[model samples]
Target: MNVDSPVFLFDQGIPGFENLRQFIFLEIEGNIPMRLMKSLEDQHISLLVVSPFFIYPEYEWELSEPVKQELLIKTEADVEVWSIVTLPAEPSQATLNLLAPLVLNRNEKVGKQLILHDSTYSSRAPLIRA
Candidate 1:
């Protein structure tokens, strides 16, 4: 199984998170709810992720043109989206930012993290209780 996959960012010549071109998504089991995102290039940088729907329901996402072209996403039918969250100092206080999401075209294992330009979202939106 692919345990540690490299995630990329758009930068230089990359269209979607080309700067963060490679990352590994690690899942921590035997725990209530915990996950780790370890960066392959810079091991020190990692973001905690969780199901955003837990807090925000009916979240909608849209991809950018450059990202679609860079990732080569053929159609809206080809993508799965996820959001990154901050592991708050306190587990209960942790929040998930649904406005911004990390998109993945699972067919090719290509993914990118993007922040929506509109200010209609919050970085620390709380995930609804499950």
Candidate 2:
């Protein structure tokens, strides 16, 4: 994941964050599996993200044809999936938004937050099993 100079350009931006189109992915220090997705347009708009597979080993999804074409994703290796993390006052109550995921094309440095409209997944799935 050599994303040193990578700038994720979201053509339509993430939902609720339409004003932000450019972002930088930065790994959170001391947290190997966590990352800081900071919007270049607004420093305050930073999202805590993590590879969903890290918490949910069975996490998987197919990118829609339109998404594949828009992101220019040709191979599976070109894509990296991440989920937004919600940290509650009680860390044990933290959750991950599984219904919507952030998919990035490592090859093209573009990304999007795709909402799974017909999926069984939940928006506030537990981040870890009890």
Clashes of each: 18, 0
- Misplaced by over 4 Å in model 2 are 1-5
lDDT of 2 by residue, 24-92 (tens): 888777957888898888878989998899888988777899999999999999999999999999999
Candidate 1 residue-wise lDDT, 19-105, digit = tens: 556666676677534356556666666777775654466666667788898777998887766667766567777677666677767
The prediction achieving the highest TM-score against the true structure is 2
Error of 2 at 95 (Å): 0.5
The lDDT of model 2 is: 0.89
Global lDDT of each model?
Answer: 0.63, 0.89
Tell me the TM-score of each prediction against the true structure: 0.70, 0.93
Residue 119 in model 2: shift from native, Å?
Answer: 0.4
Q: What is the lDDT of residue 123 in candidate 2?
A: 86
